[model samples]
Target: MIRGLQLSLNKTQKLRLESALEQLESLSSKTNTNASVAVADTIPVNYEDGVLKGHGTSEMEGQVVATVCGVVERVNKLVYVRALRARYKPEVGDIIVGRVIEVAPKRWRLEINFSQDAVLMLSSMNLPDGIQRRRTATDELNMRTIFEENDVVCAEVRGFQHDGSLHLQARSQKYGKLDRGQLLRISPYLVKRRKQHFHHLDQYGVDLILGCNGFIWVGEHVEAKDDMVVDQTNKSEQQNANSGGSVGSDDQEQSHTSLEIRQNICRIANAVRVLSALGFMVTVEVITEIVDLSSSLNLDIHEMLGAEFYVVVAEREAERRRSSTKKR
Candidate 1:
């Protein structure tokens, strides 16, 4: 796990990081006993009742066996093994962050860490004008103006196509181009689908988008726009441009993000990276705690990636889980 990072570690720091990780393993084992199964492990099942086996399961000699190393999940009469480390399995209405890979006619292909690339059609997303008009030839020609290749985007899982192609949508201002930040990838299983995926750390001027497909976005915060206000603003900007009243270069120079906000963004992003490295479920509260811990210790932003910080994070998570169990 430590090898995944490109950091230089001293003997003492390496030893400390290993020890902390061991403690975390010990704690998790106690609470998650029998919840996880290895490959070929027999899953206890009722023989008489109806059984609906799902993915990662196979039947051998009247026994349901796991074909992957993962946790066992049951729903009604259905049983499946969710692989601990596998490509994302998308569902309708899931919010995801992905990079644009291809710009085809009327559609964009995004690499969303799934079995296949996801499609974001021009017709699926809201236009810049905030209008619901049909996609025209002009729209098709100007698709790149909206989202060019390699642009990071936030969108919803529209659904799978008839041919099994995944589709995405960004009809709301809340979902669109993301910039001025970092993107972190982790195991999809580490992030569960939740009602709230977008978190704005207003105090730090950062936004945390926990994409269900394990593509995490830690970037400068952007305020959501109201459709009515956006339309009015667009009209005014157009009027100004027509009247030869474009904003001056001085105004444009002052539009860059502040240095303090950039530092905060880096701090929050490192917090996320640390949690992911430790195999902990990354949540907003835990991320905030990590940031607070670093801030209280006066640790520099880059120091957060050092081995000592990783060790501290693991130990902190262990203690947190232990205390949480005690409360339960």
Candidate 2:
């Protein structure tokens, strides 16, 4: 929260941003009634009631105490701490995006903004050929052919490994290499786990993946086909390339994303980035509204990140939340 702007700001704009921030804080405090606690803080609880301690809590010297810095939560006899500003808590079935950091013996290690690198076992995912069979040494050797270092990938939390480390799986065709787009990182708390995190803005021909790990993907929309069949033409092209022939210029051009789709990707990404910076919840509706705002005003793609646009967003968000409150 800033009274001034990262870019140049006028007095009026500064005051307006400040006012909007104050309003947002007020709304937040009103709805969030849970008491916040710090690490090792003594959590007041009725000892006679046989309190059932949960995560982020510990019993010491006959008193319920917090083990982590977070808000105190209670569910009947169960009490736990909901840590804030913490690492992404991986849960089974969570959709996440990550970058491949290492190609290991039988798996890929991915940096998913978690406590530890997540393991995507080679056996866990469906191969591009859509074959269902036992994995072999040849498949292990060709792991990089499917995914290499630094390739942005979409995956789901499979479960914790026996060693307590996070594990991932990409059995579905939707979970795989992400290209022709940008990746945005924001606070995980801003993005609540939801059923539909994969969004295709058909009007703009862009895909938006709100990864539960706080990694966002905004790129050109690719149709989700049931099978990831390798085209025979592509295979022939690969063979030609292996035989010392360069790829055709037309094929190179086809690989590049169109300027319009690229612009939309940048615009949508900027909208999410701005909302995250403003400490607002990043939801599909709010993001779409912001993108529509920029389009309606005919603002340049880069202008969406300017100080004036930030002021406008702050004001608009304040009003929208205000109206929703009134309706409720």
Candidate 3:
């Protein structure tokens, strides 16, 4: 009887439960069990308001006792799904963040926080013209330009390979190269352990670029004029700063200050490793606050490690998957 689950056993279910418990005990004893407990929805369970009513499977023999944690509902002698408390492992169709590490001729291998890098193929992409096509010589030459080493792109898991490798895709419009921003990396296990997926930051006009490899980007949109001004000012300021000289123009000074702030964003984030362990959704506000406190007060935030960056990466991945599914 886990804290959230109600124990309901029928004649068949009772026997199954007993066997499962025995197996669990044996497995636990043989090896220190690191198995994550989760509710088996496919297995027959009937419960109402924390009371067991009926069972799903009649065969009790060889069934393993599985520990489940969910809102207890009892009906007859069984327990059904009330709600999902936790889940383990990434599934097909799950939009995850990953990094491109190796580029093979037919496919690109991605480090998806799993045992192996998932493969993304040239055939997987639907070209800008909306036509599905194969890899071309031009595409091969442009492959590095499209997705290089250390470049983070949002993609979908097509399926698992025969050898347990993941098959991935980035065909749709939303899934592509991310640029002009800072990326924050966090752990995948921690991200899945948390329930809430969508962390919105409508307040700041900043956009979040999320990757399963834990790399995330937070940046604001810049118009053409703004881009030119920023580039010019940045170059001027960098030269002056390197020469140990101050700029005469206030605009240059302001640009210098902004660049310094942006550069420090990565430094401050990387310095605090513990922040990634906390699993806080790293929204723009959170970044801003950290910047303010650290730069102004010089207080070290060793406590706020493992924090997650908020992005529409999940939504974009989902949309891409849906489009792929429709096409298939």
Candidate 4:
């Protein structure tokens, strides 16, 4: 498991943490019988029946071998190892969050925690005006206006090009620039691919986007605006109103976030950080539960990162897993 947190614990706390981790290990062992192998380790397989090699597998001297350290999975003459800690593998239609790294002639290079920067072609995405016309040279020149460098963008994998580069598209309003949020990087394996990656917690006024590439975005929820809707009356009325009066400084005051909303964002973010440190599967359900648990205990958001909190979370997870096993 990935261990990135450094906690200063006393003797009892250390012992309890170790015990909780051991319990988690035992629970996983009870459920999964697949053997784990290291890189270059030969995977024992029947040779009489032709074996189909999958990801993380290579053939060496009539033997099947693993090129990554992970658990071996087999399915009807097909065998592969699912690597625990590897770069994100893009599949068509997978929604991913990425940062724009480069703006090329007709494409944008995005960093999505993959082996190579994924390509987002101008032709594949919709214009800011949400039109369905051909991309002209003007559009190509104005690409940066749509998505500049370092901007966080949400797009869907459009499949691979003939040159073996991954391609992405953002043709929908839901897929676009994300602002007013924090991005958290965790292990991609922890985020299991689900039907819905975009979640809006109406109760907390927060929008959560679980990127398949391990880039999680927690931000204020913004209602999706339809650019196609052209309200000329409202626009003319606003123009008339603005023409009559000078804009006051009060109107220009930045809308500051309320104290409560900021704290809620921090609490949710800390829950993610704690769960990542514990190497637990990070789902919306688990993250929400952790946030609720912390709130119920009246613990400050910063306290969630302390050694005691880590130990407590581990013990609680162990107990939860035990109860789950009993029910099964």
In terms of lDDT, model 2 sits at 0.88
Question: Please, what are the lDDT tens digits per residue for candidate 1 over residues 267-302?
Answer: 998998888877789889999999999999899999
lDDT of 3: 0.48
User: Model 3: per-residue lDDT, tens digit, 87-123?
Assistant: 2245666565566898888667776666667788877
Top candidate (lDDT): 2
Shift of residue 84 alpha carbon in model 3, Å: 14
RMSD of each: 3.1, 4.0, 16.4, 3.9
**Model 3 spans with C-alpha error above 4 angstroms:** 1-88, 128-134, 192-205, 210-275, 279-328
Candidate 4: regions farther than 4 A off: 226-255
Decoy 1 TM-score against native: 0.89
The best-first sequence of candidates by lDDT reads 2, 1, 4, 3
Q: Tens-digit lDDT track for model 2 on 45-114?
A: 9877779999999999988899888899899999999886778999999999999999999999999999
Ranking 1 against 3 by lDDT, winner = 1
TM-score of each: 0.89, 0.88, 0.46, 0.89
> Which 10-residue span in candidate 1 carries the lowest summed lDDT?
238-247
